[model samples]
Target: MTQRQPRRAYDEQGREIPPPTLADLRAEGDRTAFVHCDATGCGHEATISTDQFPAEMPFPDIALPLRCAACGSKEVGVMRDVVGIYARPRERTGWGMT
Candidate 1:
């Protein structure tokens, strides 16, 4: 028989709400990445695929298009660097501290 592990939860502050399991991570279409705006007070959430965004582009720091979903403005500017699989911490280190 196999033992089932408990799921983990996290708060907005990144505090561990609970311990997560392999299944938990696999939920929601294998959710692997998260995205948010760089602007202050803007707490938008966007999910991206690990395969689509190669692990080469700087993630959590890449300069992607910044358009407001609420207002729909093209005049939008890069509020903050976006986050993704390509922007993983290891990738950043591999660049040899740019």
Candidate 2:
């Protein structure tokens, strides 16, 4: 027999939200986000995975205090992928062109 995963917890709106864990992060299809150094003229975007942090540590909060590798800046900005590139239409043709 095979074992089944436990159902995720939910709030008033019935959103299935599970605790931030290493297993969960790894299972979430290469979950990635964009980050950059807050220093002026150092806007280099870096793609980091959620699994990079400690399993027990929560997101955003965990990555907030991280420093930039390129500029060695203490301030950093993180961007969550609301609409992933892979999820978008592959063939995108604008109205003006063909």
Candidate 3:
């Protein structure tokens, strides 16, 4: 893994918003971000909430310690995930049908 750069974060307006800090994430209220593996032949991805991170840290700093679980590579990227964070959970009935 070459430690590729992370993808740019975008907001609902398609505007590349968000400062490179944890405070910005907390202010937005949607603390979700997508973690991606940049290693060859490994495209592992996961949705993580900011709760996993302690306060008083920048967003990009997390990438340094992150690794692709599938390939065990230090090459990974973090992108602010804004789509499903605000989605309403489906209402399931007796049979668990949506």
Give me the candidate number with maximum lDDT: 3
Predicted candidate 1 versus true structure: per-residue lDDT over 31-65, tens digit per residue: 35454544566655555443444344433322244
- Which pairs, if any, clash in model 3? none
Model 1 reaches what TM-score against the true structure?
Answer: 0.28
* Candidate 1 global CA lDDT score: 0.41
Question: What's the distance in Å from true for residue 78, model 3?
Answer: 0.6
Q: Tens digits of per-residue lDDT for model 2 on 1-98?
A: 33332323566776656645544554555376667777998987787776567656544454566789998887786655444535645455332222
Q: Give the TM-score of candidate 3.
A: 0.62
lDDT per model, in order? 0.41, 0.60, 0.69
Sort the predicted structures by lDDT, highest score first: 3, 2, 1
lDDT of 3 at 29: 61
TM-score for each candidate, following the candidate numbering:
0.28, 0.50, 0.62
lDDT by residue for model 3 over 1-98, one digit each (tens)? 33333444566666665446777677756577788998888899988777777666778766777878788999898777745544524442224322
Better candidate by lDDT, 1 or 2: 2
